[model samples]
Target: MFDQNFIENPYPTYRALREAGSAHWNGDFLGGAWLLPRHADIAPVLRDARLSAQRSHCYSALLPEPVQPAFAEFNRVFGMWLLFQDAPEHTLLRKLMNKGFAPQVTDLWRDAITRTAHTLIDRLPAHGTVDYMGSFAHPFPALVICELMGVDARDQAEFIEWSDAIARFFGNPASSLEVAYRGRDSLLAMTRYFEAVVEQRRHAPGDDLISLLIRIEEDEEALNGEQVASQCSMLMFGGHETTRNLLGNGMLALLRHPDQMQALRDDRSRIPNAVREMLRYDSPVQYLTRIAAEDFEYAGAQIRRGQMVVPLIASGNRDETRHADADRFDIGRADTAHFAFGHGPHVCIGTRLALLEAEIAFDALLARCPHIAAVDTRPEWLANFGFRGLSTLRLDMQTQPADAGAVAA
Candidate 1:
C-alpha cells in the first residue's frame, strides 16, 4: 500500500504517495487516510477557513462510534479553546491566547531556558548512561510549564502522570479497553485539576500566566473561568508534549548522524541553523488532518464535504518537488520548510517557546556532553501516532564534564 513498509516505518509509504500524485487517498487500512504532499495543494486547504479540527468536520471517520462520544464530549468542554474553534471564533481565541506567546514573552524566556537546560543536564548521572528522554527532555518542558503556571511543587509528579496517560490516545493502537479508559480518565482528571487551579487563581492570584488570564477575563466578556481553564490546560499539555519530542527527537537525529554532531560541537554558533535542520530533518509532529468543508477536487480524486483530509506532513518534508535530496539530513540545506509547527491560522501558538526551548537545550547538551552517542540498548519510542519521540532514550556521554568554563577554554 505504501512505497515504504507501514509496519516498520511509514516514511517510504508517504514518499510513494507523494510520487503518485499531489493528493492521494487510500482506503487500504486504518479506515482510510489521505496524503496532501504538494505545497500548492496544502496551502489552499489550510487557508480555507470553513474547515476545522472539530470532530464534526472530521475528515476521517476511522474512529470507532463509541470513541466519538468521548472525543466529542471533550471537544464540547474545550470549544472556546483555540484548538477546537475555526475561522472568526478561532481568530478571537488565538488572539487572546497568543498574548502569552508574544515575541517579548519569548525573548524574556531565553535566559530561563538556558538555566533550565543547565539545571536538567546537571542532574543527569555523571558516568553511567541515562534515559535522556525521561530524565532530561520530557522534564525540561514540564519544569518550565510548572514554574510558568505557578503549579505547586508537590503537584508536579501527578501532572506528569496525567499528561503521559492522556498522551496515549495518539500512541500506538491500544492493547485493550483498560488502557483507553485510563487515558480518558486521565484527561478528565487533568481538566478537573486545572479547573480548580483556575478557580484558585481567581481568588488568590499570583504574578503568572494564570493571573494574566484572570485579568484577561475581567477585561473581556468573551472569556470566563471555564474558558480560561480549558485554554490553560491546552497550553500546558501542548507545550509540554510537543516540545518533549522536539528536544528528544532532535537529539536522536544528531546521534544518528555523527558528522553533524561534530560540526555543532566545533562551532557552537552553528547551533541555530543546526536546530532548523533538525526541525526539517525530523519533524516532531508527523501528520495533521484537516476536514474538507465542501467538495473539492484534488489530485484527480473528488473529496466530499466533511471528509477527513490528512496532510502527511512528514511526507511533505521529504517531497522531492519541494526539497532537494529530501531524504538527506543536511544541516546546510538552504530551502527548508518542515510542518513541525504546522501551517495556517491554527498553527502552533507556542512555536516561539518551543523553538527557544529546543535551541537552548541543544546548545547546552552539545556543549556539556561531547561525543554523546545513543546507548547500545534499544531506545524506547513513545507509543503515540499524534507525536513521535523516545519514551526513554538511553545515551552514553563523555565521562569528563564539559562545563561552561571547559567549553570556553
Candidate 2:
C-alpha cells in the first residue's frame, strides 16, 4: 500500500482501512506506526498531550544504519523546526514567531498577494495551453515569502530548489542515502544563508520577518542567531511549499468540478468557502507524525511509549462521518472543518496567509480566464506521501473580452 500507485490516490485504501477500524497497526510504513484513519480518532490524537510532536525520535528509529550518520545534519536542523518541537519549547517559539506572524500582519500582505497573483496571471499565455504549476502556482507563494523575508530575488530559484529538497527529506521515508545527503546539503546551504541574514539584521535590521525575528522579544526570552536562522528556514518552507500545492490542488479540484467552479466564478464571495472545501476535499499535507509521549490506549489499540502515531489528515478529511458526500468536491460545502492545516497547538501559523493567497489566486484566474479547462484529466501527482500536490497541471486558457478599463500596461 506504500507503493507509488497507492500514493497517487490512497482514498480507496483509506476507506477500506477506516471501515476496518479507527486505528490500525500498519507495519508497512514508518517501521510500524499506528495509523489513525478516522476523523474521530485522528482529531483527538492531534490534541492528545500523550502524543509528542517531536518527530526526530521517531525518525531516528526509521533511519537505516548506513544512512544514520548522513541524516545527522537533517535531524539537527529539522529538530529545531517549530513543527518538531514539543511543549515549553514549542510554546516559546510559537509565541515569539507570532509577534510577526499575527493575523493583522498577514492581512497587511493582501495587496501584495493580490498584485503578485495578477502579475503571474499577466505572464500566462492568453490563448494557449500552459503548465499552471510551473507558470504560476510554484513561484507565486515562493516569491511572496521571499519578498516578505527580504531575501534576494535573484536567489529565489535557488531557494525553491532548497525548499523542494528539504520537503523531500521530510515527506519521503524511503529516500535513499544519496537523497538524504542532498537534502542535508541544501538545508546546510539554506542555514548558512539565513545565518548571514540574521547577522546582518542584528547589525542593520530591516522591516522583513528576518529582522522581526532578530528584534522580537517575549519577556526575557529571545531567539539567538541559530534559532532565528532555523525559524526563517521553517517559515520559508511552510510559507511557500504547502501554499503552492494548495493553489495547484485547489485549481485542479475546480477544474474537475466545473459546476462548482462556475458557482465560485459567478459569486466571488464563495471563494473563501470554496478554498476551504478545496482543502477538505484534497488536503495539501496528507499526514502528520506524532510520537507516543507515554504508553496509552487509543481507539482500542495499545500504543507503546516512543511509538509513532501518524494521523492521516487526508483520510480524516474524507471520512463519511465527518461530512456528507465526503468524497465529492463541492465548493459550497458548509462543513469546512478539516485537519488539512492540522489541529491542536501545532496547527499551521501561516494558515491565514495561505488561504488569502489561494482566494486571490482563484479569484484572479477565474475572472481573467473565463474559459479554462484541464488539458489532461489524470494530472500527475507528486510522489511524496506526506505532501499531496500535482507535479504539473496543464490548462488551456481563453481570456475574457477586455472591459473598458482593461488595457495592457
Candidate 3:
C-alpha cells in the first residue's frame, strides 16, 4: 500500500479491495490489521462505540523494539490531541477547545481570510509559471493560522517545517527508523516552542487561540500548560496541512474539468457547492486508523480486540452505494455526504474553518486569475497515504488588471 503508484492514485486499488469484500485481512500491513474499504461498512464502524480512536493502546505490541522508544515522544505529543482521544476525555477536551473555534470567532476572520487570499494572489506573476502549492496554497493557511495562534510572522517558515516533519508519523506506521527519529525530534522541538509560548500567554495573554485556551474554563476545569501546548501544536499543524492540499487538489480538479471551472467562474454562487464537490471528489485526508475495543462480527469477519481497523475514506467517498456515478467528478453533485473530514464523534474540529478558507480561496483565485491553466497536468503526489495531496502544482495564469474588479467581496 505504501508503493509510489498506490500513493499517486489508490482509487483503482480501493475499488478492487471493496469488490473483494467489505473488509480484508492484511497481516502484512501494520502487523495484522483489517482494511475496511466499503462505505456501507466504514460509515458504521466509524461511529461504533466498540471502535476506539486510541490506537497506541491497541497496536503497541506490534511495534518493533527499536521504534518503541521513539514513539514514546510521538504518543506524548499526539496522544493528548483531541483526534486521538476517546469518550469523556475527548468530550472534555473538545468542549474546551471549541471555545476558541466558535462559529462567531471563525466568521469574524472572513475579512482577514479574503485579504490574505488577495495578498497572495497579487504576488502571482502575470504571464509566468509558478508552483501554486508553495507560492500560495501552502503558505496562505499557514499565515492565517499563525495569526490566529499569536505566532510571529517571522517564525511561520519554521512552524510549517516542524508541522510537516511531525505529520510523517501519521498513516505510515511502518516508517523507517530514520523517519521515526526525525518525527521524534520534530515533536520535541514543537513541544519546547509551544511550552515557552504557553508560559508567555499565562503571564501576559493576548487575543489569540493560545490566550483564549489559557483563560477558558468549563465546569471549573481548564487546560493545563502541557495540554495547552499539545492542543496548540495540533492546531498549528492540523490547521493548514489538509486545507493546503484541499486548495491544491481543488484547483487541479477545476483545471482538469474546464466546464466546471467555467461554471464556477460564470456564477460565483457555485463556488461553495464546488468546494463541497472538490472535497468529495478528491478528499484531502484519505484514511484513518481505528482499533477494535472488543470482539465484533463485521461483514462475516470476526474482528478481535486490539486489532487495527483501517477505514479507506477515499474509497468510501467513491462507493457506488453511497453516491451515484461515484467515479465522475461533478462540481454540482447533490450528495455531499463524503467522509473527507471523517465522521461521528471525531470529525475534524476545524471543519468550519477549513470550509471557509477553501471557499474564500477559490473565490479569490477565480476572480483574480481570469485564465488559469495547469503547467504540468501530471504533478507529483505526496508519499503519505493518510493525507492525499500534491507535492507541487505548477500553473500558468493571466492576472486581471488591478482595477478590473477582481477582488472578492
Candidate 4:
C-alpha cells in the first residue's frame, strides 16, 4: 500500500514524524523503508559530509534490496548534473555554470523576464481567471530559460510538458516506473536536441549560455557532450520549472496569507523580505536525499552505512530550533535562516536569480492589480519530493486602463 494521502499532503505526517522523532514505520498503509521526520535529526545528516551523494550511498543496505538495482542508473547519470555530486566535481561544474550566470549576466535578463511577466499577465481574459500555472507560472520561467539557455521560444510548451512528467520521479516511492521511463526518454530526446544546438554553437557561437558551454566544452576543462547535456537538462529544469512553481507557489502563499500580501501593497520596500519569507514558509523544494557512510549514531540509533538518508529541508525551515515561530508567515521576521535553497556546498546556484525574478514579478503584479485573488480552484502540488510548488493556480482579477481594463478598481 502506498501513502498517496501523504504524497498529496505531507505536512501532517511531517508533524507526526517530527514529534515521533526518527521512528520506523512499516505500517499497513506505509510501505518500505524507515522514516526520519524530525528537522534536527534530518539536518545534520543532510549537511554531513561523510554521508556521500554517490551511488554507494544510494544503494545502502537500509534501502530495500530490490530498490537498489532500480536506482542504479539514476545514481550514475545524475552525477553529471552537479546538484547530486559532492565535492571537487561539484565545485568545478557549478563554477562552469556560474560562469554564464555571473551577477552582471543574470541582471541582463531582468528586463526581459519582467516584460515577459507583464505580457503573459496581459493575455488573461478581462474580469475572469486563468490557470496561473499554465498561463503565467509555467510560461514565465519557460520563456526566461528558453531565451537565456538558447532554446527557441517555440519549444517552451514542450519543455513544460516534459519537465512536468519527469518531476514525478522525485519525492515518494510510489511514483510509477512508467513515469520514470517516459521521463528518461524525454530527457534523452532533449539531450540529443541540445547536442546539435551545442555543436552549432561550437562552429557559430553566440553571446548565450549555449555559446558559453561550447567554449567551456573545448577548454582544458574538457567537459564532454554528455556532461554538457547534463548541465543543459539542469538548466532547463532548475532554470524554468522551479521558477514557475516559485512564482505560483509564492502567489498562493500571498493569497493564503492576505496579511502578508497586504503588507506588500502597503509598502513596496517589503517585497524583498516578503519573497524570502515566502520561500522560507513553503519552499519550492521539500525533501533531499543522501546515503550514510560508515555506521553512524544519530538520536540514540545506529544508522548503518549504505542507509538512504532523506532530509526534509522544508521541515527544516520550520525547525523550531533554527527558526522562531516556524509555522507562521512573517515577512518582517528577522531569523528567516531557511535551508530553502538547500545547505552545504550543493545549495542552489540560481538562488539569487530566483529571488530576483520572484520579487520583481510579484511587485509588478501587485502594482498593476490591487485586488488580486485566487480563482475558485484547488492548487495542484508537483510530483517531486525535492521540489515544492503548485501544479497550477488560477487567479481572478479585473484589468485596467480600458486597454489594460478596469480590473484594479
Candidate 5:
C-alpha cells in the first residue's frame, strides 16, 4: 500500500480489503493494526466510547530505541491536541473553542474567503500552464486561516512551512525517523510561535481565534497557557492542511470529469453538492486511528485493549452497501453522507468552514477561468496513505474575469 500505484489510487485496495473480510489485521501499518474498510463497522467505532483517540503514545513506540526520547515533546504536544483527546477534556475544550468556529462565526468570513479566492485566481497566468496547488490551493486556505488567527501576512510563508512539515509526517503512516524529526521540530517551532502570539493577544485582544481562546481562558479559567497554545497549533495545522488538499483534490476530480464540471458551471447551486461529491470521490483524509479502550468483540474478532484500530474513511465513502453507484463521481448526486470529515465525537469541527471555502473556491475558479484543463492526464499524487492528495496539479487556464456590469447584475 505504500507504493506509488496505491498512493495514486487506494480505492481499489480499499475495495479488496472490504471484500476479503470485515476487518483485516495488518502487521505492517504503524506496528500492526486492524483495518476497518466497511462503513457499517467504522461508523460505530467512531461513536463508540470504548475506542480512544489518544494514540500519541504509538508515535514514540514506533521510533528506534535510542531516539525515542527525542519525540517526548512531540508526544506531549500531539496528545494535547483536540483531535487526540476523549470525553471530559475533549468536551470542555470543544465547547470553549466553539465560540470561534460556530457556523455564525464562520459565516462572518464569507466575504473574506471569497475575496481571497478571487485574488489568488486573478494572479494565475491567462493562457499557459500553471501549478494550481502552489498558486491557489495551498495558499488560499493558509491565507484565510492566517486572517482568522490575526497572524501577520509576512509570516504566512513560515506558517506554511511548519504546516507542511507536520502534515507530511502525520499524514504518512510509513514515515521515517527523519520525517519524525522534522515533524517534531516543526511542531515545536509552531507551538513557540503561537505561544508568543498568545502572549501578545493577552496584552491586546482582537476578534481573532487567538483572542477568543485567551478570553476562554480568562473568563472560564479552563485552559492554561500551554493548552491554549496547543490548540492554536492544532487549529493552524488542521485549518490549513485538510482544506488545501480538498481544493487540490476537488479541482483534479473536476478536471477529470468534464461533465460534472459543466454541471456545476451550468447551475451554481450545485456547487455545494459538488463539493460533497468531491469529498466522497477523493477524501483529503483517508483514515483515522484509534486505540481500543477496552476488550470488545467487533466483526467476530476480539480486539485487545491498547491495540490500534484504523477506520478507512475513504474506503467507507466508496462502500457500495451505503452509497448507490459509490464509485461514480456525480456532482448532482443527492447522497452526501461521507466520513471525509469523520463522525461522532472526533468529527471535524471545521466541516462547515471547509465546505464554504471549497464552494467559494470552485465558484470563483469557474467564474473567472471559463476554460480549465489539466496539463497532464497522469496526476501526481503525494506519497501518503493516510492523507490522499496531489503533490502537484498543473493546469491550463483561460482567464475571463466577470465584467463590471455582470458583477453589478
Candidate 6:
C-alpha cells in the first residue's frame, strides 16, 4: 500500500481496510502498528484513555537502537510538544498554551492574514498558468504564522525547509534512516533558531505568540525558556504545514467540482461550510498515531501495550456509516462530521486559526480570480500519506482588475 498509487489516492485502500475488518496489523507501518480504518472505531479510540498520546517511543523504534541516541534533540523537542503528551501533562500544557491562542488573541491578526493573502495573490500572473502551491498555498500561511510568531517573514524559506524535512520523516512510515537523520537535523536547527528568538523576546517582548508564551512562563512558571522555544518550533510547524496543504487540497477540490466552486462564488456566506466540506472531503491531515497505554480489546482486535495505534483520519472522514454519499464532494453537506482536525483532547490547537485562514483565503481567491481552471486536471500528489496534499497545483486564472472587487484582497 506504500506505492505511488496508494500515495496518490489512499481512499480505495482505506475503504478496503474498513470493509475487511475493524483493524489490520501492518508490519511495515512504523515497524508494525494496528490500522484503525472506520470512523466509529477511530472516534472512540482517539478519546480512549488506554490509547496514550506519547508516541515518541514508537518513533524511536523506526531507527536502529544504536542510532536512536543521535536523535536526542529530536526526542527532546517532541517531548515538549503537547501532541505527544497525555492526561494531566497534556491538560496543563494545553491550558497554558491556550492563553496565547485565545480567540480574542487570534482575532487580532485578521487584518494581517488578509493582507498576506492579497499580497501573495497580487504577485500571481495576470492571465497565465501558475503553480498555486508555490504562488499562494505554501507561502501565504508561512508568512501569516511568521507574523504571529514574531519571526522574520524573510526566514519563511528556512522555516518551510525545516518543517518539510520533519514532516516527510514523520508522515511516511516507510522513511529511511537517512530521511530520519535529515529530520533530526532540521528539528535541531529549528529549535536552536527559536532559542535565540525566545531570548530576544525575553529582553524586548512583542505582541506575538513567542512573547505571549514568555509571559505565560513568567506568570505561571509552568514552562522554561527552552520549553517555550520548543513550543514555538511546534507552533510554527503546526501553524503552516497542514494549513498549506489545506489551501492546495481545498482549491484543487473546488477546481474539480465546478458546481461546488460556483456555489461558493455565488454566495460568499457558504464559504465557511465550503471550508468544512473541503476539510472533510480531502483532509490535509490524514493520520494520527498513538501508543496503546494498556492491553485492551477494541473493535474485536486485541491491542497490546506499547503497540502503536494508527488512526486513519482521512478514512474516518469518508466512513459511509457516518456520512451519506461519503465519496462525493458536496460543500453543502450537513453531516460534515470528520476527524480532519481530529477529535477529543489531542485535536489540533490550530484548528480555529486554520479555519479562519482558509475562509479568508477562499473568499479572497474567489473574489479576485473571477475565472479559474486547473492547468493540470490530474495533478500529482506528494508521496506523503500522513499529510495528504498536492505536490503542486497549476491553475489557469483570469484575475480581476486591480481596482475591481469590494473584497479588498
Candidate 1: which pairs clash?
A: 4-12, 4-13, 59-307, 59-308, 60-308, 170-385, 171-383, 171-384, 172-383
Model 3, global lDDT: 0.84
Off by over 4 Å in 3: 56-63, 401-409
Candidate 5: deviation at residue 311, Å?
0.5
Error of 6 at 249 (Å): 0.8
Q: In terms of TM-score, how similar is model 3 to the real structure?
A: 0.95
Extract clashing residue pairs from model 6.
Answer: none
Q: Predicted candidate 4: what Cα RMSD to the true structure?
A: 4.2
Give the poorly placed runs of model 2, Cα more than 4 Å off.
400-409
Q: Write the per-residue lDDT of candidate 2 for residues 1-409, one digit (tens) a residue.
A: 8787776788998899999997888786777789999999887889999999888644544667866776677688879988888898999999998888788788888877777777788788779999999999999999898888898877889989998887777787567666667778888899889999898888898888889888889899999999999988888888878999999989988888889888987898899999999899899998999889899999999999988899999999999998999999988787889999999999998888888889888877877888889999789988888888988999899765433242221
Q: How does candidate 5 score on lDDT?
A: 0.86
Indicate the residue-level lDDT of 268 in model 2: 87
Q: Which scores greater on TM-score, model 1 or model 4?
A: 1
TM-score (C-alpha, index-matched) for candidate 2: 0.96
**What's the distance in Å from true for residue 316, model 3?**
0.8
lDDT of 6 by residue, 1-409 (tens): 8898988788899999999988999988898899999888988999999998888656666788898888776887877788888988888888888888889988888888888888888888889998889899988888999998979999999999998888888788867898888888888899999999989998999888888888884245567789888888888888878999999989988888899999889999998888999999899998999988889998888899988899998999999998988999998998777799889998888888999999999988998899899988689788787898887988888776444445443
Off by over 4 Å in 1: 1-8, 28-30, 56-72, 78-80, 171-176, 217-222, 399-409
lDDT of 2: 0.85
Report every candidate's CA lDDT: 0.71, 0.85, 0.84, 0.69, 0.86, 0.87
Instruction: Write one digit per residue (lDDT tens) for candidate 1, span 1-409.
Output: 4321342256777776776788776564234555676655666676676556764223113356676566555545545457767766777777777777779867876766677778778787767778788888888888888777888756767877877776665343322455555655766677788789888988999877777776763245556787777777777778888888888778887788788888788888887787777777767777776666777676666888766677767777777777888888877677767777888887889888888888788888877776588885456676566577777888876534547664332
Listed in order, each prediction's TM-score against the native is 0.89, 0.96, 0.95, 0.87, 0.97, 0.97
Error of model 6, residue 271, in angstroms: 0.6
Question: Residue 28 in model 1: shift from native, Å?
Answer: 6.1
Worst 10 residues of 3 by lDDT: 400-409
Please identify which of the two predictions, 4 or 5, would achieve the higher lDDT against the true structure.
5
